[model samples]
Target chain A: MLLQILNIVGIVAFAASGALVGVRKQLDVFGICVVGATTGIGGGILRDLLLGVHPPDSLSKWPNITASVATSLVVFFAHPVLDRIWSAVVLFDALGMGLFAAGGATVALQHGSGALGGVLIGATAAIGGGVIRDMLVNEVPLLLQRDLYALPALLGALLVVVCESIDLPQGISLIAGTAAATGLRCLALWQRWQLPRARVKD
Target chain B: MLLQILNIVGIVAFAASGALVGVRKQLDVFGICVVGATTGIGGGILRDLLLGVHPPDSLSKWPNITASVATSLVVFFAHPVLDRIWSAVVLFDALGMGLFAAGGATVALQHGSGALGGVLIGATAAIGGGVIRDMLVNEVPLLLQRDLYALPALLGALLVVVCESIDLPQGISLIAGTAAATGLRCLALWQRWQLPRARVKD
Candidate 1:
């Protein structure tokens, strides 16, 4: 029941984030929904594909699709209201990322994916959506940018793997992983942390 | 034996096209290989995922991976020579696209995908790779642009569907589909065909 709730909220939050980007880029309503849905479920789709899940859970679940589409519609119409609560939305987005990373790692581990595959698939699930969204708009993905986005997700995945290695309780690991990733992301946002870049002329 | 030959050639041709794009972007050798391999096998991977084929054929097949990587290395070293025969490369790329489209449709049909599913999956196979390569490089995918790329692929897929509905020989359908798609693409190149776009002032 708790996992179901988190899935719904994560889908909505990610859909809202993609909808915001689509609106900023001046996409049509259909285009906005496409981007929003892709962002909401694309990662899970990739993870499922890699792990050999047929039909993919996200694609087969009507409620998940409906939630993402409805959230995109709400975002499209409620931009002015959303603007006021932008910080809260950002927080939710961070929480969504943490949940996805940890959740993906747990899924892969349960599927008998190796330790390396668990962490890699976990990170892929966290950032794949945003990378795809940026690609659609012809912008550099924040993953390769200075943002400390990927690192937190990786840390969360790695932590989950560690828990599994030590036979720790699944619930304990999941909660801790989410907290670790979300905390690091919020701190980076607050401190304006950035990775160093090479000083080469393009 | 003939199908194997075509698969090898198709992978190499697509890899070369991707490698050329990576070269123009001035990516490192590793990055170039990554882009090339994605372009070569990404479409197949997407098609397999959509069709619920586990372990995607591209990932499991070592020869396919080796061939694409070797072709990327060749493109990286022999770019100047490749530039002189760029027209030839474009021709082969078109042929590869056609083969992938028709071949993908046949596979889907065999898998019991309906007529619509077959065509859509086939087009997905034809364009999925380039979309992914562009995504990795942070470029707008060519599919959304004015290029006459997707229509020909769709046409090929449609032809395959038609043949299947009429119970035609597989060999005839495959050849006819490939010829139609490649012919249209070549003609478009010669005439510089483009899709009309909405002119909204940004």
Candidate 2:
């Protein structure tokens, strides 16, 4: 039940980001839909493909696709109203990051991926959508920039793994991961947190 | 030798098309390179992935990548000059279609794909680069248009498949396939060929 909720939130957040990027890029309705769909599902597609899961969930699952498309349309027609609810957008995105992070690690674990592999997969799943979104929009990936972006997902996945090792309930681990990721992302945004940059050589 | 030559020619042609689209989209040098690279190699990547081939050839075969990047740089600096060489571009592109069609079919057959699958793969391999390029530029895929974009590759694959059934030499079959595809493409271009469009219900 919790996973399902998080999945919906992630789809909505991803679609919203995709629509915003499409609007910023001055793309039309079709373009907006493409970006939204790609952003919402790109990471999971990559993960599933790498795991040798044929067709991928994004293609096989109707609800995920519907959610992505619906979110894009909503954003397309009502971005001004949605923009007024910026906190809601951030909250949705943070929820998505945590959900994807946990989902990725869980899937990788099911595939018999090692702890390190799970961590990597979780991180990839969390950020893969955003990377594809930025690429489609012809912008440098937000992942390449150092912020709270990938780190939050990493910590969330790590927490999930740790809790699993100690025999904690999966639901609790998932919720804890979501909360950690959300809090970190909110803090990062509020504080304008950035990673240290390398000094220019003379 | 001929397949290798065709591959190089196809990569260059696709690269040129990618560069042209990038120019139209007002992308920077990096963006142009991305478009060129994806256009030159995206189909092969998809094919390899579906075939469960790890890392994909484009990642491991640096020469093919070099060909794409070099072609992109050339197009970037010499757009004006290359624009005047339209006939040469078309001719090279035709040769590329012929070569890649055969190559895609051969690879699929090696992987035990059925005759129909081989044909589909061949057609996809031939036009995949252009499809990706169009998507990246936020345009509808050129292959989906009324142009005879995918037909030459289909014919080429058909010839190869027919020859294989008749116990013909592989070399001869490849040559025959290339000739068929090239002739069809050239004829289509000369005749200003187009597929019939559906009537719109107003």
Candidate 3:
């Protein structure tokens, strides 16, 4: 029951973020809904596909799609004040990312992926939807470039694997993993943390 | 035997197109190779995943990876003048798109996807790679916006389904599908064909 709630919340968070981006980009309602739906479920779908899950539960199940589309439409019609909601959206996005990273690792481990593969798959699940969302609007996946985004996801996933390896309770380990990722992301957002890049001298 | 050859050619062509985009974006060699490899195999992987092919042959097989990476490297090192070979690249890309569309639909039908499903999967196979490539470089997928790209792919896929329904020989039908898609795409390139879009009055 709790897991289902988490998934629903994650869908809403992700969908809201996607819808906001679509509005910012001036896409029509249909385009916004498409982006929102893809962003909400793209990661889980990719994770399931990688883990050999046929047809992907997220795709097969209607609730997830309905939630994503409905949230997007609500956001679109709200005529949101971008400055007011942008930070809140980021917060929800961070929460979604953290939850997804931990959740995805658990799924991968259940499917017999190794520790290393679990971490990779987890990060993919956390970030894949955002990547798709950005691609639709022709922007660089800001998830990859700016902020300490993927690192937190990896750390969270790793924590989950570590907990599993150490025989910790799944519930406790999941909470720890999500907390670590979410905290780190929130801190990064607060502090404007970014990884350095290699620049060739002109 | 013929199908394998077609897949290999498609991989090479798609990889070349991806590498060229990387060069245009001025990405580093590693980035270019990543883009190229993804472009070569992404479409097929997506099609298979959606059609319930577990682990997707493109992901499990090394030859696909090797071909894509090697082609990318060759293209990067060759450093050909763009104006000289761009038209040629367009021709090869169109051929790749056509072959993959037909090939993907055939695979879908064999796996028991109905006609409509087969057509959608076929177009996904044709365009998914380029979408990934463009996403990597942060460009609007020129494939979608301009030119008769997707329409030809859908038509090609449809042709394959039509032939199957009519009991045409597989080889003849595949050939017909490929020719139709490729010829249409090339003609569009020559004529600059594009679908009309909704423009909001300023």
**Candidate with better TM-score, 1 vs 2:** 2
lDDT of 3: 0.80
Q: Which residue pairs overlap in candidate 1's backbone?
A: none
Kindly list the per-residue Cα lDDT of model 3 for residues B1-202, writing each as its tens digit. 6666777788888888877766665665655666677789888888887887755667556677689989988877775544545555566678888889888888899899999998999889998998777767676785765668899999999999999999998887788888999899989888887678889999
The top-ranked prediction according to DockQ is 1
What does the lDDT read for residue A52 in candidate 2? 79
Docking level of model 3:
incorrect
lDDT of 1 by residue, B85-170 (tens): 54754665687788888887887788776776677678778878777877777676655442577778889988999998999998
Model 2, residue B26: distance off in Å is: 15
Enumerate residue pairs that collide in model 3. Answer: none
* Candidate 1 residue lDDT tens string, A17-91: 777776666665655666677788877778888898765677556777788889878877766555444464466
Error of 1 at A70 (Å): 3.0
- Share of real contacts kept by model 2? 0.03
Displacement of residue B14 (Cα, Å) in model 3 is 1.5
Model 2 residue runs over 4 Å out of place are A1-5, A84-91, A144-146, B1-16, B19-38, B50-202
For model 2, residues A20-136, the per-residue Cα lDDT tens digits are 666555555555665776678777777777677644566445677788989877876766555434454455566667778887776777687878877888778888888777665
